[model samples]
Target: MFDKAFQRVNTFEDFRTELVEGKENRAGEELIQESRKKQKVDDDKETTELKQCLEIIPDEEEVTIDAIPLAVKSPRIVDWKIHKEGTKSYYQIIRADRKSQMYMIFSHMLKSFEREHLEDLYKLVKARYGSTRPVESMDYLLWNDMKIMFELHVEDEVWKLQQGYKVLEWKLYDSCGVHSLMMQSMQIYMLVEKKYPLTPPTLSMMLERSFKLIMKVKWLISCVN
Candidate 1:
């Protein structure tokens, strides 16, 4: 009888232990579920915030004008020619004059006198120094001045374009070749000033003399041969 009573006590202890273990397992599962639900809520909030941020940012390849985003168009190269004269060569290009809306809006930003001055400088450089020495041998101070002036003008023009509801498209600005045109103009100015200085007996005269000497040497060499 004692052995049977001891077996019953052991069975009751096992049942009590199983009941306690089951309660602990259920509490752990509930804690895990709560943690998972909190994580899901946090993830959803982050996703919604990311979407809102993306909505606030503009597209990379589009420019906004007058509250409307417009795609940038490729610039058209209408006409281009390379002319060779004597030992010098130069390019003449006439690009399609289809102006961008940004350009049209800011066209009047450059004053008429400034426009005339730029045109006159172009004409003077072309007419006076059409065929001259390389730009490397030109006046350094003059070249730097021209560069500074050109850069300032470009910056001012860009600022004007950026004013109001207009955003400047760099691709379109680069394709327009305005910077290239200005650089060419500056080079021409340097070359012309170097070749045909206002002072008498210019550097070009000395270069011409040196060229004549070279030609004479070549003539003598041919005769000896």
Candidate 2:
């Protein structure tokens, strides 16, 4: 009875008109075309909404966690890319700055790594920077558990560390009821290296923002109700 559904589908516009306006849509060809068109429309809608949401203006709020002052140089983060594989997300970051000195100093830290393997990266840092006589093995991965993000220092000039694996900071948002939402930054650092360099002094700083993705999930579910 439906054999005529396909053979009569000559012009695409006519077939689509039948498919959408009535039940006489072609069974095979027109169905595929209609599916593609619907998908494009959904994709366009999402793109527009995302642009509107992220256009929020940045606002700086006064927050005090530690005794540390709110005066911090805004370290520029560039080419922020986020990849979600499973439950957790992986971020590829790049940090760009006005002075190449910052990048050059960062390369010094990488030279401390003797092994090409990642497991030994923490071990290498401890070996190179013998602290107070006893050098205990470092747990780099465990740093994540403590909410430590990334470590940075420029031998004698600059040294800083963040808590979140990404840069988490509160920006002032006028639209939000309070003022700001803490935004975590995923950044990458790049520097021109001389290859073999001296051991640069490395320092770690704890971030004030205590963000737990797990906790956020629960809060989100509550809002849905």
Candidate 3:
């Protein structure tokens, strides 16, 4: 049971002492030269290992097929907001230059789409812009199908109609009677024209405004009669 078949393993201090003893036994010039060469090889290996470790850099966050920005303008959209409930991924986008105008687009049918599609889009954007920066926001969540929520800068176009209503308001103040009532109705018609393809709620609001103006005009006519 107590058989001393093998020598005990070298401790750190014991190993260093043995190396020193071995060096002392050798010819000083040749042994010193050989030890220096071995040390240099080990130093080179360590430097290489450190360089390799430093070369490994961590990756950053990337764009995917879940969200993408678009170049369009609409009043309905609230700029920079992601509308998730109605569609899988709906975004109220605006051009980088003009935040006053905004638009909306749906990304893909499924909440989770293929990553390969995103790669394709990335390539396409890179090719077109010579860099992904132009479409950095636009191309990320892009899908084959896209629907423009409203015409480009519809808000700016609506301003013209607003100017017309202002003019009508000025005329109403100047002439209070049948003339003013008719002017109010004219402005209401213009409002209807300005907002064509109106939703049911919008149409109802327009009709109500028009109806009230007509009632006022009829009341004026009856007072004269």
lDDT of 1 by residue, 181-217 (tens): 1211122122221222112223344355557778999
Q: Please report how far candidate 1 places residue 173 from its true position, in Å.
A: 17
For residues 53-131, could you state the per-residue lDDT of candidate 2 as single tens digits?
8764456855545765543433334332334557544433333453222212222323322222222333343454434
Say which prediction, candidate 2 or candidate 3, comes out ahead on lDDT: 3
Candidate 3, residue 197: lDDT:
35
**For model 1, how many clashes?**
0
Candidate 3: TM-score? 0.18
What's the lDDT for residue 95 in model 1? 35
Lowest lDDT sum, 10 consecutive residues, model 1, at 167-176
Report the Cα RMSD per candidate.
22.6, 24.9, 23.6
Assess every candidate by TM-score.
0.30, 0.16, 0.18
| CA lDDT scores, all candidates in order | 0.41, 0.36, 0.39
Best-fitting candidate, scored by lDDT: 1
